[model samples]
Target: MTAALLAGVLAGYGIAIPVGAVGTYLVSLTARTTLRTGVCAALGVATADGLYALAATLGGPALAAALRPVLGPLRWVCVLVLLALAAWGAAGAVRRYRHHRLATHAGAAPVSPARAYLALLGITLLNPTTVIYFAALVLGSQTGDAAGSGERVVFVAAAFAASASWQVLLAGGGALLGRMLTGHRGRLVTALVASGVMTALALRMAVAPV
Candidate 1:
């Protein structure tokens, strides 16, 4: 159990610490919204991670083989979705900045915490890497045969906790960023930069060898 827990922690951090397109978006989303919404989004990401981990534990090597064939197409879809999100974020930030500058209160309402949670969850779920990472960890560890039911539970729980903690820390950093850049122009600039970073990362993911 202890070894399984440790392995799970390492696996969770291995996947979550990469700070790819999804991580970039999470920080930017938090910067544009409240910490409460950011926390919800963070949980959403952690939830997806946990779900993938669970699937890996249950399905083992067979799951990995099944998913390998679909990875190429799935990655393309992920790239397109990320590109769309980047464009939307950039345009929305500009529109919001203009409205704020003009002191017009008729702009679109802020995203609610629930919606933020669901949106992040969906975005994270679309990333095939999460499942592949989990599957790889499971197969590489050779834990399927040795780990009993309780050990598997502990592993999954530890992974979820580790991921949640890291994601929340990211949200906290984003909140700090939002506080630092409270000005309209500062927020707009930050949003644009983040959007650019996200787009670049998405393109990299698309072109990366599977």
Candidate 2:
């Protein structure tokens, strides 16, 4: 049990610590919105991680094998999704800057906490590689060769908690950034930069070997 707990925590941080395109989006989104919304979104990400971890624990090696067949397609889909998000963010930033007023993409309503949560959850779920990552870890480490049900449960819970804690910390940092960059120009610059990074990341993902 202790081994499972330790391994699960380590696995969670191992995956969550890598701040990629989604992480950039999370921070930028938080900077544009409220801490409450950001935290909810962060939880959404953690929830995805937890679900992946659970699948890995339950399915073991077979999960990775099953995912391998669709890996390339999934990556393409993820790239498209990320690119769309980048375009929307960039457009929204420019529009808001020109009008000197805060607004969301396409005149959409401001992101509520619920909306943010669902958006983040959907975005995170697009990356099917997360499950493979968890599967590899579970097969090679976490719950060992064959984890019992109780051990699997503990591992999943620990992984979720670890991921949640780290994501919340990131959201807090983004909130701080929002406070610091209160001016329109500052927000505009930050948003554009984030959009640029997100675009580059999406393109990079598209070109990466599957």
Candidate 3:
């Protein structure tokens, strides 16, 4: 159980530590919106990761094999989803900047925390890499053997906790950045840069060999 727990923690951090397109978007989104919203979104992301980890643990090799067949299609879908999201964010930033009321506009519609959570969760779920990552770790840690249900549960919980901590930290940093750069131009620049980065990442993912 301890070995499974440690392995899960390491696996979670290994995947979450990278500040990829989604990470950039999370930070920028938080910077633009309120911290509460950011926290909800962060949890959404973590929840997705945790769910994937659980799937990997429970399904083992069979799950990994099933995913391999559809991975290429899934990757393309993920890329498209992320690109769409980036465009939306960029457009919102542009509109806010042009109006010169970026802050007010950002917080205009009091977004429900539940909705925010669901949105982020849905977006994160579109990321096929998370499942692949979890699968690789499960394969490595299984020691050429299957794990018992108890061990799998511990593994999943550890993975979830690890991912949650990292995501929360990202949201916190974004909230700090937002507090620092509350000006219209600052928000505009940050949002645009983040969108660009996410677009680039999506392109890379799309073109990557399946």
Candidate 3 Cα errors over 4 Å, as ranges: 103-110, 143-145
Please give the range of 10 consecutive residues that has the lowest summed lDDT in model 1: 101-110
Q: Write one digit per residue (lDDT tens) for candidate 2, span 1-210.
A: 998888779878888888888788999999998899999999999999888888878876776678788878888888888888888888888888888876544466779999999998888887755755775675675354488988898888988899889888889999999899988898888888988898898888888887
Which ranking of candidates, highest lDDT first? 1, 2, 3
Shift of residue 179 alpha carbon in model 2, Å: 0.8
lDDT of 3 by residue, 1-210 (tens): 898889779877877889897788788878887788888988898899888888877776777788888878888888988899789888888888888885534436755667778987887787777857866765665722477877788877887888889988999999999999988899888888988999999999988887
Please report the TM-score between candidate 2 and the true structure.
0.94
Choose the strongest candidate by lDDT: 1
lDDT of 1 by residue, 1-210 (tens): 898899778767878888988888889988888899899999999988888877777777887888888888888888998999899888887887987752211266677889889998998888968856876876787656567888889888888889999999999999899889988898889889988998998899988998
TM-scores of the models, in the order given: 0.94, 0.94, 0.92
| Lowest summed lDDT window (length 10), candidate 2 | 136-145
Tell me how candidate 2 scores on lDDT.
Answer: 0.83
lDDT of each: 0.83, 0.83, 0.81
Q: Give the Å error, residue 142, model 2.
A: 6.7
